[model samples]
Target: MEMVQMLRENATLLKLGYQFELPGPRMAATGILTRNQDQQRQKRMQERKAEEVVEQKSATSSNQEVPTRKIAEMVKHQEVCNKAQIRKPKTKKLKNGANEKESEDILKDLRNNLKPSVKSRHEASNLPPPQRSGRDDLMAAIRGSSIFSLKRVNLT
Candidate 1:
């Protein structure tokens, strides 16, 4: 047929490094060319493996073992401590009227304890300011742009 001849011509052109545009739909009503039965068997085997993995996970979750060593260690530590002496020490109750006076005394002690450093403000400020150049600006611009953008493209 003419269609078959055209297909053969296209194949020859393609082999010779020439591009050819085929016209219309060239589909045939024939069955698939790849008739390998091994692929189906492999797919079924993979499904069975996945099912086994799921079964194993479910089995592990249902039959989880408690750590007996950790439980025993906790029990042993509890037995060593005396419950009566382990109770938290009671804080001395502060009288409502004396609380304000006590707080003022604490603040006074804190303010008296703080000592001013020997360094003068002018001495700290005497350090030179950092220098900026055009190179820094160029580097920042390069970092902001994508590396892929640096690639050269030919329009022709």
Candidate 2:
């Protein structure tokens, strides 16, 4: 029993090849360095295992806490409040070759004419082909029927 107690007490000193009261500071430093290295290795192994577990969790994200937001709660589109821009009419006068005037009636008449008109079934059939104004107005493209297929027949 006495021998076992002595051995247990001197275990660290014995491992460092020391005799009688732990030799010098150099030997003690060597032992400490080796122990520190072992601890560092264990720490590195634990970090590697932790990284692997995190990778697995990320790979299976569906079952885990999915960072989600309800699509319905989000505003899909916001109403665009366009600033009213009153464009100057290209024609400086009325259709009757009148002088330039900034009357409200003239402006209102011009605005009404500029707006696109949706033709009904009967109106579309009777609508005449729009004149190619060479401008980019959408109304210029609205034609009743295509004139390409209409060939003039001479009944002579």
Candidate 3:
């Protein structure tokens, strides 16, 4: 009887060891699920904020009669803002070596000064393309980097 009991215990330990050696997803917990949900929530929030800015710009434009000169300025401002926002990440590679914080400040200022809009007839006639892909802007960033500058000297 004692021998049978010892064999049963050994079998149970071997089964547990084999199970532990099996490879599978280790994060079988609620933490990963909550983290993913949080990321999705933040993404939704950013999209909503961008939409709100567009709506506000449209509302203001419709309620007020902006002169052609002002409209032109707004369009120019919007274009500049769009460009800055697009190039924000690449600012670090600039010849002057602007830091991340400065680029972020510039972006904040641009966003504060101008908002994007939905094209009404007047805006449709005047407006340029709303946004371009990152690939389209990559060459521009590379050309503007210090690597392309013949006049730049490395102090190091």
Candidate 4:
């Protein structure tokens, strides 16, 4: 009775039709509350802090900046030099137009020959005859016997 009274005292009354939430282990557990605006603001502040850190690092090493800049320029210049030095051999244009046409025609003929011919639906449905078993032979013999014959003969 005391525990029930304590629970009733700690319970929160909801606005919707006398619904109450009793304070227990489950009720005490807090869930994550998501606020998009707050999260976005925090993300922006983190990015700004990162940018400031990069700026401060660059500002601190003035002597190192010159060598780094020179190295980047040298890398770009070397890439350009390498691209200019290595020339791809230009493809020679075929002079014989007749030979090109002949080769294309030969390829078309070979491709057509390599392709399999499709069978018609009627031919595809043609199945092999079913193999007879001992049970089938027994059934046929019983049907042919005179004792179990289903035929009726009329006599005048």
Candidate 5:
């Protein structure tokens, strides 16, 4: 009686309609709650097993339809290709026309300078070529055979 009075003092248990029943033949009715919980758990397990078996059957059926599946994949690929844009390849022209005159003059001067020296093997020496300052003006002066022309020749 004291335990029942103590339990009844709890506002939460009273709100949830909890009954403080004594241990006796009356307690046999509580076995229904345990049986209900077990039944719900068993139902959920059977549902999960059924779902897995259904998925396995669908997978096996899809494998059997392999030819149709390939045709569907090819159709999807064609749709993707059609949605994309086809572009023309880019091309560039290589022209050396502008420097033709300058190159020809340089070639003529180099030929004139090398020919006479090649004929006379006594002029050949194992000395390094002379370095030049003021690159543009000096290179033009040497090519034109102007001032300091012999000292400024470009060696190969």
Candidate 6:
């Protein structure tokens, strides 16, 4: 009976040892997985570096130096000089015009005609009184529309 029990125990120990044995192919599979993970990490780093380069280029392009005040003043002076040169012919044409007195009279008449009309004190005193409300004004406008609404036909 003791020998049989010892034999059974030895069989159980052997089975446990077999179950714990590492498979040869599994080690190679794990090595492939680690290499793939390393490749993925390297790819991500390269993409990040490329993005940084693009960002740096754009930042540099946007940061141009502004022109100084002296340069702006020089440009303005050149423009004024150019405009003065262009207007010299117009000044000569004005000097060559005929009948200056007649032109002056016409200009005076035009100025007088374009002046705004002013109400005299007596005329303002004779004006009609203001209406009491918006409704009264609207009614007045409606009553005054008959002349505008009249229709006329050509006889010829």
lDDT of each: 0.61, 0.58, 0.64, 0.63, 0.64, 0.65
Return the lDDT, model 1, position 37.
Answer: 39
TM-score ranking from best candidate downward: 5, 6, 4, 3, 2, 1
On lDDT, the leading prediction is: 6
lDDT of 2 by residue, 1-156 (tens): 333344444534323353434455555555555665676778899999999999888888855564345443343322222222334445555667655564667888999888767655568779798766656454545454368855779998
Q: How do the residues 18-132 of candidate 6 rate in per-residue lDDT, one tens digit apiece?
A: 1213555444444444555666778899999999999999888776555578789999999999999988875323445757787788899999888765666568879898757
lDDT value, residue 126 of candidate 2: 92
Tens digits of per-residue lDDT, candidate 4, 69-95, equal: 789899999999888778756654555
List ranges where model 6 is wrong by over 4 Å: 1-21, 68-156
- Ranking 2 against 3 by lDDT, winner: 3
User: Which residue pairs does candidate 1 place in steric collision?
Assistant: none
**1 or 4, which is superior by lDDT?**
4
Candidates 1 and 6 compared: the better one by lDDT is: 6
Cα displacement (Å) at residue 130, model 5: 86
Cα misplacement distance, residue 14 of candidate 6 (Å): 35
- lDDT string for model 5 (20-138, tens) is 46664224334444455566778899999999999999999988967987889999998888666354345443356546677778889998987867536655555566776698777
TM-scores for all candidates: the values are 0.22, 0.24, 0.25, 0.25, 0.30, 0.29
- Candidate 1 is scored at a TM of 0.22
Clashes in model 4: which pairs? none
So what's the TM-score on candidate 2?
0.24
What is the Cα-based lDDT of residue 81 in candidate 4?
88
Residue 34's lDDT within candidate 5 is: 49
lDDT of 4 at 18: 26
**Residue 123 lDDT in candidate 6:** 83
- As for lDDT, the candidate ahead, 3 or 6, is 6
User: Worst ten-residue run, lDDT, model 5?
Assistant: 7-16
Model 3: which ten-residue window has the lowest total lDDT? Answer: 11-20
lDDT of 4 at 97: 50
Q: Which residue pairs in candidate 2 collide?
A: none
TM-score, cand. 5 vs. native: 0.30
